[model samples]
Target: MAQAGGRIRIGISGWTYAPWRGVFYPKGLRRKDELSYAARQVTSIEINGTFYGQQKPQNFAAWGAAVPEDFVFSVKAPRFLTHIRRLREVETPLANFLAGGLLSLGPKLGPILWQLPPSFRFDAEGMARFLDLLPQDTEEAARLARRHDDRLKGRAVLETDACRPLRHAIEIRHESFRDIRFVDMLRARGVALVCADTVSWPRLMDATADFMYCRLHGSEELYASGYNDAALDDWARRCRAWASGREPGDAERVGPRGARVPRDVYVYFDNDLKVRAPADARSLMGRLKLLAADGTPRR
Candidate 1:
């Protein structure tokens, strides 16, 4: 569907405490009114805490009622699915754990993030068996781990029918998934790569799918301290470009210093330092609105 005002959809991570403009907004302002305020301006959010455990169905229902229908929520699947199982032998406990909370997320749920632990590096045999074990309920995610081994031989596995459009994005923290060949492996399998922008790990910012997923930890400036107004404003400009496809006339020559131009980007701030995530997100959303007024770049 077409986006609002030809602008890209924008969202922050989970609602966390930030002074004035943290990830979602300031903690002091996180009352029902504040959440509603932020929700009106942004498009979606990644529910991060779900990784720890499932929430009660009442909680999910309340959340669903809170956000607008257009709003989408991407939830991190609990550790049981990604970290604990790691495609090893399936256990009833694991299945029960996933089913417990995921089923409660209801329809507003967008994607179930299967973020593998950093220690669990690429392993074909282990990953293949893991892939086979993933529950049919959760949809879409990349198997970046298994692509590394030439010893592995098989077509890219796809279970679109089982989960329908539910898909996964491979989060390649290590350099191993950096290779285009590896990314191509995911693309062929229909796994959208998770585009993460951090001072440490920057994935290739390419259009891997029509629906983009991004988690922006921080730039070199705020990488350590979390995001500030300036940092968020910069990102908002890029988001405008991604959503609308409009870029500055001198974009090619502008380099990094020019007046902010939209880059094809979707981001969620992870820099939770000093409760800055929400405040930064609010600031970022304001700048993006300004950019949208100027021009929107869409793909």
Candidate 2:
């Protein structure tokens, strides 16, 4: 089908999973070809490895080259900043992460997900300061990367292609982030509040930015359960509404409603256990008319 409304991308969180190898991945497929294979079935993917430690520039380049020109990869920000520092005194760590070759993804880079630990409560001042340190565009990111300490001397990639807008999203697991002030702060900085659906997370649906980031980690179970037809039908409805610049009347919001404007929507299935992530992702894409029954783009 031809392009319509705001963009809607449905995909899995990460491409590599042992359980997904013989299941999601074709039997006998080489491990090295997994990313390219998954990219063809989904519109986007969230790179989870980047969250653990620094990734080589060559790795980023190879990953970028593996996907189609239109495919996008949302990189999870380092946990050292969120888990270890708890968003405090993270200027240098954030800079080091920026210097860690994400720029090599270039056009394939999507939102940067900064997922706070469940123990990290909402602190207005601390969150505000941390948000300020994030670069709004690729050029600004390169400038920040230039400030990296001696840690990234040899492996850092501080260069970027032509300037392009960069987006950031925060996935809060603690209930303290329910404060309207937190939502307002995110809105002011244009950072998206990730709508993470899980059995335990807060699952806030506030529209704090121009685009929406959603992670369906399984409603009844954290990462093992699958979404039945009825559940996915509901999600498809909400995705369409959000893409058309509207939120469900009953949406759980911490702050006032945002202005009506077209919004791009990115949804990733993080329920990777039992190989449900890719299955649900492809199903959602099919519901959105993005993919056909035969794994081809809708025509």
Each candidate structure's TM-score, on Cα atoms with residue i matched to residue i, is: 0.65, 0.97
Runs off by more than 4 Å, candidate 2: 1-4
Find the 10 residues in a row with the least total lDDT in model 1: 250-259
Q: Write the per-residue lDDT of candidate 1 for residues 167-283, one digit (tens) a residue.
A: 455565665555555544454454546767676654454444334466776666443356666656656555555555444232221012211223223456665655555555545
Per candidate, the number of residue pairs that clash is 32, 2
> Which regions of candidate 1 deviate over 4 angstroms?
1-7, 18-38, 90-94, 101-107, 128-164, 221-265, 290-299
Any residue pairs clashing in model 2, and if so which? 1-298, 1-299
- Global lDDT of each candidate: 0.52, 0.89
lDDT of 1: 0.52
Question: Per-residue lDDT for 1-299 in model 2, tens only?
Answer: 22335688888888889988788889999999999999988889999998888888889999999998888899999999999999889889988988888999999999999999999898888888889888999999999999999988889999998799999999999999999999998999999999999999998889999899999999998988899999899899888888888887658888888878768899999998879998888788788889876777543
The CA lDDT at 30 in model 1 is 40
